[model samples]
Target: MKETTGFREKVVIITGASSGIGKAVSLQLASEGACVSLAARNAERLQEIAQECNQLGGSAIAIPTDIADQQQCRNLITKTVEKFGRIDMLVNNAGFTVVDKFEDLQTLELFQRVMNVNFNGAVQCTYFALPHLKNTHGRIVNISSLGGIVPFPGNASYAASKAAMTGFSDSLRLELQDDQVSVTMIYPGAVVTKFQEHRLDKDGQVRGSDGGSLYTEDMMTADECAEIIIEAAKQRKREVVMKPGKISRWIKLISPSLLDKIIIERVKKIIEREAQESK
Candidate 1:
Protein backbone atom coordinates (compact mmCIF):
# COMPACT_ATOMS: atom_id res chain seq x y z
CA MET A 1 0.00 0.00 0.00
CA LYS A 2 1.17 3.52 -0.74
CA GLU A 3 1.43 6.21 1.93
CA THR A 4 -1.73 8.30 1.94
CA THR A 5 -2.58 11.82 3.01
CA GLY A 6 -4.14 12.16 6.44
CA PHE A 7 -7.45 13.81 7.43
CA ARG A 8 -6.47 17.30 8.55
CA GLU A 9 -8.99 19.97 7.66
CA LYS A 10 -10.55 17.57 5.16
CA VAL A 11 -14.32 17.79 4.94
CA VAL A 12 -16.20 14.57 5.77
CA ILE A 13 -19.87 13.62 5.94
CA ILE A 14 -20.85 10.70 8.18
CA THR A 15 -24.33 9.20 8.24
CA GLY A 16 -25.64 7.53 11.43
CA ALA A 17 -23.65 10.07 13.41
CA SER A 18 -25.81 9.89 16.51
CA SER A 19 -24.28 6.62 17.78
CA GLY A 20 -22.02 3.61 17.36
CA ILE A 21 -19.23 3.46 14.80
CA GLY A 22 -20.31 6.66 13.07
CA LYS A 23 -20.11 8.64 16.28
CA ALA A 24 -16.77 7.07 17.12
CA VAL A 25 -15.39 7.90 13.70
CA SER A 26 -16.62 11.48 14.05
CA LEU A 27 -14.81 12.04 17.34
CA GLN A 28 -11.58 10.48 16.07
CA LEU A 29 -11.57 12.65 12.98
CA ALA A 30 -12.45 15.71 15.05
CA SER A 31 -9.48 15.13 17.32
CA GLU A 32 -7.34 15.08 14.18
CA GLY A 33 -8.84 18.39 12.99
CA ALA A 34 -11.11 17.07 10.23
CA CYS A 35 -14.22 19.13 9.49
CA VAL A 36 -17.09 16.70 10.03
CA SER A 37 -20.67 17.03 8.84
CA LEU A 38 -22.81 14.75 11.02
CA ALA A 39 -26.10 13.36 9.72
CA ALA A 40 -28.79 11.25 11.41
CA ARG A 41 -32.45 11.29 12.27
CA ASN A 42 -31.61 12.05 15.89
CA ALA A 43 -31.33 15.80 15.67
CA GLU A 44 -30.61 16.43 19.35
CA ARG A 45 -27.85 13.90 19.61
CA LEU A 46 -26.44 14.95 16.27
CA GLN A 47 -26.10 18.53 17.50
CA GLU A 48 -24.47 17.30 20.70
CA ILE A 49 -21.88 15.32 18.69
CA ALA A 50 -21.20 18.29 16.48
CA GLN A 51 -20.51 20.40 19.53
CA GLU A 52 -18.22 17.73 20.93
CA CYS A 53 -16.37 17.57 17.61
CA ASN A 54 -15.87 21.32 17.58
CA GLN A 55 -14.52 21.22 21.13
CA LEU A 56 -12.20 18.38 20.10
CA GLY A 57 -10.51 20.72 17.57
CA GLY A 58 -12.42 20.18 14.32
CA SER A 59 -15.15 22.16 12.65
CA ALA A 60 -18.44 20.26 12.90
CA ILE A 61 -22.07 20.73 11.93
CA ALA A 62 -25.11 18.59 12.51
CA ILE A 63 -27.39 17.91 9.58
CA PRO A 64 -30.46 16.04 10.75
CA THR A 65 -31.44 13.65 7.99
CA ASP A 66 -33.15 10.39 7.24
CA ILE A 67 -30.97 9.00 4.50
CA ALA A 68 -33.72 6.64 3.37
CA ASP A 69 -35.34 9.71 1.82
CA GLN A 70 -33.68 10.82 -1.39
CA GLN A 71 -34.32 14.51 -0.70
CA GLN A 72 -32.83 14.22 2.77
CA CYS A 73 -29.76 12.53 1.26
CA ARG A 74 -29.31 15.45 -1.08
CA ASN A 75 -29.79 17.93 1.74
CA LEU A 76 -27.09 16.24 3.78
CA ILE A 77 -24.56 16.72 1.00
CA THR A 78 -25.73 20.20 0.11
CA LYS A 79 -25.57 21.42 3.69
CA THR A 80 -22.13 19.93 4.20
CA VAL A 81 -20.74 21.64 1.14
CA GLU A 82 -22.40 24.90 2.12
CA LYS A 83 -20.68 24.70 5.50
CA PHE A 84 -17.25 23.47 4.43
CA GLY A 85 -16.86 24.52 0.77
CA ARG A 86 -15.79 20.99 -0.32
CA ILE A 87 -16.10 17.35 0.72
CA ASP A 88 -13.15 14.99 0.99
CA MET A 89 -14.89 11.90 2.35
CA LEU A 90 -18.35 10.46 2.58
CA VAL A 91 -18.76 7.69 5.19
CA ASN A 92 -21.90 5.68 4.48
CA ASN A 93 -22.39 4.29 7.98
CA ALA A 94 -26.17 4.45 8.33
CA GLY A 95 -28.01 1.11 8.62
CA PHE A 96 -30.49 -0.89 10.72
CA THR A 97 -32.11 -4.35 10.78
CA VAL A 98 -34.80 -6.43 12.44
CA VAL A 99 -33.98 -9.50 14.47
CA ASP A 100 -36.26 -12.28 13.23
CA LYS A 101 -36.40 -15.18 10.82
CA PHE A 102 -37.00 -14.07 7.22
CA GLU A 103 -40.35 -15.89 7.05
CA ASP A 104 -41.49 -14.36 10.37
CA LEU A 105 -41.42 -10.80 9.06
CA GLN A 106 -44.89 -9.24 9.14
CA THR A 107 -44.53 -7.48 5.81
CA LEU A 108 -42.25 -7.56 2.80
CA GLU A 109 -41.95 -3.79 3.34
CA LEU A 110 -39.71 -4.57 6.32
CA PHE A 111 -37.05 -5.82 3.94
CA GLN A 112 -37.56 -2.80 1.71
CA ARG A 113 -37.14 -0.53 4.71
CA VAL A 114 -33.80 -2.09 5.53
CA MET A 115 -32.66 -1.94 1.91
CA ASN A 116 -33.67 1.71 1.66
CA VAL A 117 -31.33 2.85 4.40
CA ASN A 118 -28.56 0.28 4.12
CA PHE A 119 -28.14 0.18 0.35
CA ASN A 120 -30.17 2.77 -1.54
CA GLY A 121 -29.57 5.50 1.01
CA ALA A 122 -25.82 5.18 0.68
CA VAL A 123 -26.11 5.15 -3.08
CA GLN A 124 -28.27 8.26 -2.92
CA CYS A 125 -25.84 10.11 -0.70
CA THR A 126 -23.00 9.09 -3.02
CA TYR A 127 -24.92 10.26 -6.02
CA PHE A 128 -25.23 13.76 -4.57
CA ALA A 129 -21.74 13.84 -3.01
CA LEU A 130 -19.86 12.32 -5.95
CA PRO A 131 -19.41 15.55 -7.82
CA HIS A 132 -17.82 17.21 -4.78
CA LEU A 133 -15.73 14.11 -4.00
CA LYS A 134 -14.44 14.05 -7.55
CA ASN A 135 -13.42 17.67 -7.30
CA THR A 136 -11.29 16.93 -4.23
CA HIS A 137 -10.11 13.44 -5.19
CA GLY A 138 -11.95 12.22 -2.14
CA ARG A 139 -12.56 8.82 -0.53
CA ILE A 140 -15.74 6.84 0.02
CA VAL A 141 -15.53 4.63 3.09
CA ASN A 142 -18.56 2.35 2.96
CA ILE A 143 -19.31 0.66 6.27
CA SER A 144 -20.47 -2.76 5.13
CA SER A 145 -20.86 -5.84 7.37
CA LEU A 146 -19.44 -9.37 7.68
CA GLY A 147 -22.97 -10.49 6.81
CA GLY A 148 -22.56 -8.85 3.40
CA ILE A 149 -20.23 -11.65 2.33
CA VAL A 150 -21.39 -14.40 4.70
CA PRO A 151 -24.86 -15.76 5.39
CA PHE A 152 -26.04 -14.51 8.78
CA PRO A 153 -29.05 -16.48 10.03
CA GLY A 154 -32.23 -14.76 11.31
CA ASN A 155 -31.16 -11.52 9.62
CA ALA A 156 -31.10 -12.36 5.96
CA SER A 157 -32.86 -9.10 5.18
CA TYR A 158 -29.93 -7.18 6.64
CA ALA A 159 -27.52 -9.52 4.89
CA ALA A 160 -29.20 -9.01 1.56
CA SER A 161 -29.04 -5.24 1.87
CA LYS A 162 -25.36 -5.30 2.73
CA ALA A 163 -24.67 -7.71 -0.13
CA ALA A 164 -26.12 -5.12 -2.45
CA MET A 165 -23.78 -2.54 -0.89
CA THR A 166 -20.76 -4.82 -1.34
CA GLY A 167 -21.51 -5.32 -5.01
CA PHE A 168 -22.16 -1.61 -5.56
CA SER A 169 -18.99 -0.48 -3.81
CA ASP A 170 -16.79 -2.84 -5.84
CA SER A 171 -18.31 -1.78 -9.13
CA LEU A 172 -18.13 1.90 -8.15
CA ARG A 173 -14.47 1.44 -7.26
CA LEU A 174 -13.73 0.22 -10.76
CA GLU A 175 -15.75 3.00 -12.34
CA LEU A 176 -13.95 5.70 -10.36
CA GLN A 177 -10.46 4.18 -10.63
CA ASP A 178 -9.21 6.83 -13.00
CA ASP A 179 -11.05 9.63 -11.23
CA GLN A 180 -8.99 9.25 -7.98
CA VAL A 181 -12.00 8.89 -5.67
CA SER A 182 -10.90 5.94 -3.53
CA VAL A 183 -13.53 3.46 -2.34
CA THR A 184 -12.90 1.56 0.90
CA MET A 185 -15.36 -1.08 2.10
CA ILE A 186 -15.36 -2.23 5.71
CA TYR A 187 -16.85 -5.58 6.81
CA PRO A 188 -17.01 -5.50 10.58
CA GLY A 189 -17.84 -8.22 13.09
CA ALA A 190 -19.84 -7.52 16.24
CA VAL A 191 -19.14 -4.37 18.22
CA VAL A 192 -20.54 -3.04 21.48
CA THR A 193 -23.12 -0.30 20.82
CA LYS A 194 -26.74 0.75 21.24
CA PHE A 195 -27.37 -0.53 17.72
CA GLN A 196 -27.77 -4.05 19.09
CA GLU A 197 -30.57 -2.88 21.36
CA HIS A 198 -32.65 -1.40 18.55
CA ARG A 199 -34.13 -4.54 16.96
CA LEU A 200 -37.18 -3.90 14.83
CA ASP A 201 -40.41 -5.55 15.97
CA LYS A 202 -42.71 -7.46 13.61
CA ASP A 203 -44.73 -4.27 13.22
CA GLY A 204 -41.67 -2.55 11.72
CA GLN A 205 -41.13 -0.27 14.70
CA VAL A 206 -37.82 -0.03 16.58
CA ARG A 207 -37.51 -2.06 19.78
CA GLY A 208 -35.15 -2.10 22.75
CA SER A 209 -33.65 1.28 21.82
CA ASP A 210 -33.08 2.08 25.49
CA GLY A 211 -31.79 -1.42 26.33
CA GLY A 212 -28.47 -3.19 26.63
CA SER A 213 -26.30 -5.12 24.18
CA LEU A 214 -28.23 -8.12 22.79
CA TYR A 215 -25.22 -10.43 22.87
CA THR A 216 -24.15 -11.97 26.16
CA GLU A 217 -20.43 -12.11 25.59
CA ASP A 218 -17.94 -9.24 25.51
CA MET A 219 -17.38 -7.59 22.16
CA MET A 220 -15.13 -4.97 20.58
CA THR A 221 -15.87 -1.36 21.52
CA ALA A 222 -17.11 1.16 18.96
CA ASP A 223 -13.93 3.17 19.56
CA GLU A 224 -11.74 0.21 18.61
CA CYS A 225 -13.84 -0.37 15.53
CA ALA A 226 -13.56 3.31 14.62
CA GLU A 227 -9.81 3.28 15.08
CA ILE A 228 -9.49 0.48 12.55
CA ILE A 229 -11.86 2.26 10.18
CA ILE A 230 -10.09 5.62 10.34
CA GLU A 231 -6.71 4.01 9.76
CA ALA A 232 -8.00 2.17 6.72
CA ALA A 233 -9.60 5.30 5.31
CA LYS A 234 -6.44 7.32 5.90
CA GLN A 235 -4.37 4.69 4.17
CA ARG A 236 -7.03 4.45 1.46
CA LYS A 237 -7.02 0.64 1.62
CA ARG A 238 -9.00 -1.23 -1.03
CA GLU A 239 -11.21 -3.01 1.53
CA VAL A 240 -11.09 -4.24 5.11
CA VAL A 241 -12.61 -7.38 6.66
CA MET A 242 -10.82 -7.64 9.97
CA LYS A 243 -9.87 -10.89 11.76
CA PRO A 244 -12.68 -13.43 12.40
CA GLY A 245 -14.74 -11.75 9.68
CA LYS A 246 -11.89 -12.50 7.30
CA ILE A 247 -11.93 -16.10 8.48
CA SER A 248 -15.70 -16.28 8.01
CA ARG A 249 -15.50 -15.14 4.40
CA TRP A 250 -12.81 -17.74 3.65
CA ILE A 251 -14.89 -20.53 5.27
CA LYS A 252 -17.96 -19.37 3.35
CA LEU A 253 -16.16 -19.75 0.03
CA ILE A 254 -14.56 -23.14 0.79
CA SER A 255 -17.12 -24.94 3.00
CA PRO A 256 -20.52 -23.28 2.87
CA SER A 257 -22.32 -26.33 4.33
CA LEU A 258 -20.03 -26.29 7.36
CA LEU A 259 -20.74 -22.60 7.83
CA ASP A 260 -24.50 -23.25 7.63
CA LYS A 261 -24.35 -25.68 10.55
CA ILE A 262 -22.57 -23.07 12.65
CA ILE A 263 -25.15 -20.43 11.75
CA ILE A 264 -28.03 -22.79 12.63
CA GLU A 265 -26.63 -23.27 16.11
CA ARG A 266 -26.21 -19.56 16.55
CA VAL A 267 -29.72 -18.87 15.29
CA LYS A 268 -31.15 -21.41 17.75
CA LYS A 269 -29.53 -19.57 20.62
CA ILE A 270 -30.90 -16.26 19.34
CA ILE A 271 -34.37 -17.78 19.12
CA GLU A 272 -34.11 -19.06 22.68
CA ARG A 273 -33.17 -15.57 23.87
CA GLU A 274 -36.00 -13.91 21.96
CA ALA A 275 -38.46 -16.36 23.53
CA GLN A 276 -37.16 -15.56 26.98
CA GLU A 277 -37.36 -11.84 26.29
CA SER A 278 -40.96 -12.13 25.13
CA LYS A 279 -41.87 -13.99 28.29
Candidate 2:
Protein backbone atom coordinates (compact mmCIF):
# COMPACT_ATOMS: atom_id res chain seq x y z
CA MET A 1 0.00 0.00 0.00
CA LYS A 2 1.30 3.42 -0.95
CA GLU A 3 1.78 5.83 1.87
CA THR A 4 -0.45 8.75 1.04
CA THR A 5 1.14 12.07 1.93
CA GLY A 6 -2.35 13.32 2.73
CA PHE A 7 -2.31 12.09 6.33
CA ARG A 8 -1.00 15.54 7.18
CA GLU A 9 -2.80 17.28 10.04
CA LYS A 10 -5.04 14.28 10.64
CA VAL A 11 -5.69 13.14 14.22
CA VAL A 12 -5.34 9.41 15.02
CA ILE A 13 -6.15 7.56 18.22
CA ILE A 14 -4.33 4.23 18.75
CA THR A 15 -4.90 1.84 21.62
CA GLY A 16 -2.07 -0.53 22.72
CA ALA A 17 0.32 2.17 21.57
CA SER A 18 2.94 1.40 24.17
CA SER A 19 4.65 -1.29 22.12
CA GLY A 20 4.58 -3.77 19.25
CA ILE A 21 2.28 -3.23 16.26
CA GLY A 22 0.40 -0.34 17.81
CA LYS A 23 3.61 1.56 18.58
CA ALA A 24 4.93 0.93 15.08
CA VAL A 25 1.68 2.20 13.51
CA SER A 26 1.69 5.27 15.75
CA LEU A 27 5.22 6.11 14.67
CA GLN A 28 4.47 5.48 11.02
CA LEU A 29 1.30 7.56 11.03
CA ALA A 30 2.87 10.36 13.05
CA SER A 31 5.91 10.53 10.80
CA GLU A 32 3.60 10.65 7.82
CA GLY A 33 2.03 13.81 9.36
CA ALA A 34 -0.79 12.57 11.57
CA CYS A 35 -1.09 13.92 15.09
CA VAL A 36 -1.15 10.76 17.24
CA SER A 37 -2.60 10.01 20.64
CA LEU A 38 -0.90 6.90 22.15
CA ALA A 39 -3.06 5.02 24.63
CA ALA A 40 -1.79 2.11 26.80
CA ARG A 41 -1.48 1.08 30.41
CA ASN A 42 2.29 1.29 30.72
CA ALA A 43 3.08 4.96 31.28
CA GLU A 44 6.81 4.50 30.83
CA ARG A 45 6.49 2.69 27.54
CA LEU A 46 3.96 5.22 26.33
CA GLN A 47 6.36 8.05 27.22
CA GLU A 48 9.20 6.35 25.38
CA ILE A 49 7.14 5.96 22.21
CA ALA A 50 5.77 9.51 22.49
CA GLN A 51 9.32 10.83 22.80
CA GLU A 52 10.36 8.91 19.73
CA CYS A 53 7.48 10.37 17.73
CA ASN A 54 8.27 13.89 18.94
CA GLN A 55 11.94 13.44 18.09
CA LEU A 56 10.96 12.32 14.61
CA GLY A 57 9.42 15.78 14.13
CA GLY A 58 5.90 14.45 14.60
CA SER A 59 3.24 15.52 17.09
CA ALA A 60 2.11 12.94 19.72
CA ILE A 61 0.89 12.50 23.28
CA ALA A 62 1.00 9.54 25.66
CA ILE A 63 -2.27 8.82 27.39
CA PRO A 64 -1.97 5.95 29.85
CA THR A 65 -5.18 3.99 29.61
CA ASP A 66 -6.67 0.68 30.74
CA ILE A 67 -9.02 0.00 27.87
CA ALA A 68 -10.94 -2.61 29.84
CA ASP A 69 -12.72 0.19 31.66
CA GLN A 70 -15.51 1.79 29.68
CA GLN A 71 -15.14 5.13 31.48
CA GLN A 72 -11.47 5.26 30.69
CA CYS A 73 -12.14 4.39 27.07
CA ARG A 74 -14.66 7.23 26.90
CA ASN A 75 -12.20 9.59 28.54
CA LEU A 76 -9.52 8.66 26.00
CA ILE A 77 -11.70 9.68 23.05
CA THR A 78 -12.84 12.83 24.85
CA LYS A 79 -9.27 13.90 25.60
CA THR A 80 -8.11 13.20 22.06
CA VAL A 81 -10.88 15.37 20.62
CA GLU A 82 -10.13 18.07 23.17
CA LYS A 83 -6.46 18.05 22.30
CA PHE A 84 -6.73 17.68 18.52
CA GLY A 85 -10.23 19.14 17.97
CA ARG A 86 -11.26 16.04 15.99
CA ILE A 87 -10.62 12.34 15.52
CA ASP A 88 -10.01 11.14 11.98
CA MET A 89 -9.03 7.55 12.76
CA LEU A 90 -9.14 5.03 15.57
CA VAL A 91 -7.03 1.84 15.79
CA ASN A 92 -8.34 -0.67 18.28
CA ASN A 93 -5.26 -2.81 18.89
CA ALA A 94 -5.10 -3.58 22.60
CA GLY A 95 -5.18 -7.38 23.08
CA PHE A 96 -3.35 -10.42 24.42
CA THR A 97 -3.81 -14.18 24.51
CA VAL A 98 -4.79 -16.71 27.14
CA VAL A 99 -3.45 -19.80 25.44
CA ASP A 100 -3.93 -22.83 27.67
CA LYS A 101 -5.71 -26.11 27.64
CA PHE A 102 -9.44 -25.74 28.26
CA GLU A 103 -9.30 -28.00 31.28
CA ASP A 104 -6.43 -26.04 32.83
CA LEU A 105 -7.85 -22.61 32.12
CA GLN A 106 -10.20 -20.66 34.36
CA THR A 107 -12.80 -20.49 31.64
CA LEU A 108 -15.28 -17.90 32.81
CA GLU A 109 -12.78 -15.47 34.30
CA LEU A 110 -10.35 -15.69 31.41
CA PHE A 111 -13.13 -15.44 28.88
CA GLN A 112 -14.47 -12.32 30.55
CA ARG A 113 -11.07 -10.68 30.72
CA VAL A 114 -10.32 -11.39 27.10
CA MET A 115 -13.76 -10.26 26.00
CA ASN A 116 -13.59 -7.11 28.13
CA VAL A 117 -10.38 -5.87 26.56
CA ASN A 118 -10.57 -7.32 23.06
CA PHE A 119 -14.30 -6.88 22.38
CA ASN A 120 -15.84 -4.55 24.97
CA GLY A 121 -12.90 -2.20 24.89
CA ALA A 122 -13.14 -1.78 21.14
CA VAL A 123 -16.86 -1.26 21.41
CA GLN A 124 -16.49 1.45 24.03
CA CYS A 125 -13.79 3.27 22.10
CA THR A 126 -15.78 3.13 18.87
CA TYR A 127 -18.96 4.15 20.63
CA PHE A 128 -17.35 7.20 22.16
CA ALA A 129 -15.52 8.12 18.95
CA LEU A 130 -18.58 7.61 16.74
CA PRO A 131 -19.64 11.26 16.72
CA HIS A 132 -16.19 12.46 15.80
CA LEU A 133 -15.67 9.67 13.28
CA LYS A 134 -19.08 10.39 11.79
CA ASN A 135 -18.33 14.09 11.57
CA THR A 136 -15.08 13.41 9.72
CA HIS A 137 -16.17 10.28 7.91
CA GLY A 138 -13.19 8.68 9.61
CA ARG A 139 -12.01 5.09 9.76
CA ILE A 140 -11.92 2.35 12.40
CA VAL A 141 -9.30 -0.41 12.16
CA ASN A 142 -9.73 -3.40 14.46
CA ILE A 143 -6.86 -5.82 15.03
CA SER A 144 -8.25 -9.33 15.16
CA SER A 145 -6.37 -12.61 14.62
CA LEU A 146 -6.42 -15.63 12.32
CA GLY A 147 -7.64 -17.62 15.28
CA GLY A 148 -10.83 -15.64 15.09
CA ILE A 149 -11.57 -16.99 11.62
CA VAL A 150 -10.08 -20.47 12.10
CA PRO A 151 -10.46 -22.04 15.49
CA PHE A 152 -7.37 -23.27 17.33
CA PRO A 153 -7.12 -25.37 20.44
CA GLY A 154 -5.63 -23.87 23.64
CA ASN A 155 -6.82 -20.40 22.57
CA ALA A 156 -10.53 -20.77 23.09
CA SER A 157 -11.00 -17.55 25.05
CA TYR A 158 -8.78 -15.44 22.86
CA ALA A 159 -10.29 -16.82 19.70
CA ALA A 160 -13.79 -16.21 20.98
CA SER A 161 -12.98 -12.58 21.81
CA LYS A 162 -11.47 -11.90 18.40
CA ALA A 163 -14.39 -13.59 16.64
CA ALA A 164 -16.73 -11.33 18.62
CA MET A 165 -14.79 -8.32 17.37
CA THR A 166 -14.98 -9.58 13.80
CA GLY A 167 -18.75 -10.00 13.98
CA PHE A 168 -19.11 -6.65 15.71
CA SER A 169 -17.00 -4.94 13.09
CA ASP A 170 -19.19 -6.35 10.34
CA SER A 171 -22.43 -5.21 11.96
CA LEU A 172 -21.01 -1.83 12.87
CA ARG A 173 -19.65 -1.33 9.37
CA LEU A 174 -23.11 -1.77 7.88
CA GLU A 175 -24.66 0.55 10.46
CA LEU A 176 -22.11 3.26 9.70
CA GLN A 177 -22.11 2.74 5.94
CA ASP A 178 -24.69 5.46 5.34
CA ASP A 179 -22.66 7.80 7.55
CA GLN A 180 -19.51 7.13 5.47
CA VAL A 181 -17.51 5.81 8.39
CA SER A 182 -15.40 2.82 7.41
CA VAL A 183 -14.60 -0.14 9.64
CA THR A 184 -11.72 -2.43 8.76
CA MET A 185 -10.92 -5.71 10.48
CA ILE A 186 -7.32 -6.94 10.42
CA TYR A 187 -6.52 -10.65 10.73
CA PRO A 188 -2.83 -11.36 11.13
CA GLY A 189 -1.31 -14.80 11.38
CA ALA A 190 1.66 -15.19 13.72
CA VAL A 191 3.62 -11.99 14.53
CA VAL A 192 6.52 -11.57 16.92
CA THR A 193 5.00 -9.46 19.70
CA LYS A 194 4.76 -9.47 23.50
CA PHE A 195 1.18 -10.69 23.35
CA GLN A 196 1.66 -14.20 24.73
CA GLU A 197 3.66 -13.13 27.75
CA HIS A 198 1.42 -10.17 28.51
CA ARG A 199 -1.71 -12.25 28.93
CA LEU A 200 -3.29 -11.73 32.34
CA ASP A 201 -4.42 -14.35 34.79
CA LYS A 202 -7.50 -14.19 36.97
CA ASP A 203 -5.54 -12.24 39.60
CA GLY A 204 -4.27 -9.78 36.99
CA GLN A 205 -0.75 -11.21 37.18
CA VAL A 206 0.84 -11.55 33.76
CA ARG A 207 1.49 -15.11 32.68
CA GLY A 208 5.19 -15.83 32.33
CA SER A 209 7.02 -18.32 30.21
CA ASP A 210 10.66 -19.27 30.19
CA GLY A 211 12.30 -17.83 27.06
CA GLY A 212 8.88 -16.37 26.19
CA SER A 213 7.99 -17.90 22.87
CA LEU A 214 4.59 -19.02 21.63
CA TYR A 215 4.41 -17.88 17.99
CA THR A 216 5.17 -20.27 15.18
CA GLU A 217 8.67 -20.12 13.63
CA ASP A 218 7.56 -18.26 10.50
CA MET A 219 6.15 -15.29 12.42
CA MET A 220 6.50 -11.90 10.74
CA THR A 221 7.83 -8.79 12.43
CA ALA A 222 5.59 -6.20 14.03
CA ASP A 223 6.56 -3.62 11.39
CA GLU A 224 5.21 -5.85 8.63
CA CYS A 225 2.00 -6.35 10.56
CA ALA A 226 1.61 -2.61 11.12
CA GLU A 227 2.19 -1.82 7.46
CA ILE A 228 -0.62 -4.12 6.41
CA ILE A 229 -2.92 -2.66 9.03
CA ILE A 230 -2.16 0.85 7.80
CA GLU A 231 -3.08 -0.12 4.28
CA ALA A 232 -6.37 -1.65 5.38
CA ALA A 233 -7.18 1.56 7.20
CA LYS A 234 -6.21 3.82 4.32
CA GLN A 235 -7.95 1.79 1.64
CA ARG A 236 -10.92 1.33 3.97
CA LYS A 237 -10.81 -2.33 3.08
CA ARG A 238 -13.51 -4.57 4.53
CA GLU A 239 -10.90 -7.03 5.83
CA VAL A 240 -7.14 -7.57 5.72
CA VAL A 241 -5.59 -10.97 6.28
CA MET A 242 -1.80 -10.90 6.35
CA LYS A 243 0.84 -13.58 5.96
CA PRO A 244 -1.71 -15.69 4.15
CA GLY A 245 0.26 -18.89 4.65
CA LYS A 246 -0.34 -21.47 1.96
CA ILE A 247 -0.74 -24.48 4.23
CA SER A 248 -2.61 -22.47 6.87
CA ARG A 249 -5.18 -20.89 4.57
CA TRP A 250 -5.62 -24.13 2.73
CA ILE A 251 -6.22 -25.95 5.98
CA LYS A 252 -8.79 -23.36 7.01
CA LEU A 253 -10.71 -23.61 3.74
CA ILE A 254 -10.09 -26.99 2.17
CA SER A 255 -10.58 -29.07 5.29
CA PRO A 256 -11.64 -27.40 8.54
CA SER A 257 -12.09 -30.80 10.21
CA LEU A 258 -8.51 -31.71 9.43
CA LEU A 259 -7.41 -28.34 10.75
CA ASP A 260 -9.17 -29.02 14.01
CA LYS A 261 -7.41 -32.36 14.28
CA ILE A 262 -4.05 -30.70 13.75
CA ILE A 263 -4.83 -28.06 16.38
CA ILE A 264 -5.83 -30.73 18.88
CA GLU A 265 -2.59 -32.64 18.35
CA ARG A 266 -0.44 -29.51 18.84
CA VAL A 267 -2.42 -28.48 21.89
CA LYS A 268 -1.94 -31.90 23.42
CA LYS A 269 1.78 -31.57 22.89
CA ILE A 270 1.76 -28.15 24.51
CA ILE A 271 -0.13 -29.50 27.50
CA GLU A 272 2.31 -32.37 27.87
CA ARG A 273 5.28 -29.99 27.80
CA GLU A 274 3.71 -27.78 30.44
CA ALA A 275 2.98 -30.75 32.62
CA GLN A 276 6.54 -32.11 32.39
CA GLU A 277 8.07 -28.70 33.15
CA SER A 278 5.84 -28.16 36.16
CA LYS A 279 6.97 -31.48 37.59
lDDT of 2 at 129: 95
Candidate 1 residues 1-279, lDDT tens each?
345677999999999999999999999999999999999999999999999999999999999999999999999999999889999999999998876778888779888888999999999999999999999989999999888877677788899989999899999999998889999999888888887777686677677754463555567789999999999998989999965787777778999888888878877886687678767
Worst 10 residues of 1 by lDDT: 209-218
RMSD (Cα, Å) of candidate 1?
A: 1.8
lDDT of each: 0.89, 0.84
TM-scores for candidates 1 onward, in order: 0.94, 0.89
* Residue 199's lDDT in candidate 2: 71
Task: Please provide, for model 2 over 21-134, each residue's C-alpha lDDT reduced to its tens digit, 9 standing for 90 to 100.
Answer: 999899988788789999999999999999998887678988899999999998899889888899999999998877666677644787778889988999999999999999
Q: What stretches of model 1 exceed 4 Å from their correct place?
A: 209-213, 273-279
For candidate 2, the per-residue lDDT at 239 reads 89
Candidate 2's TM-score reads 0.89
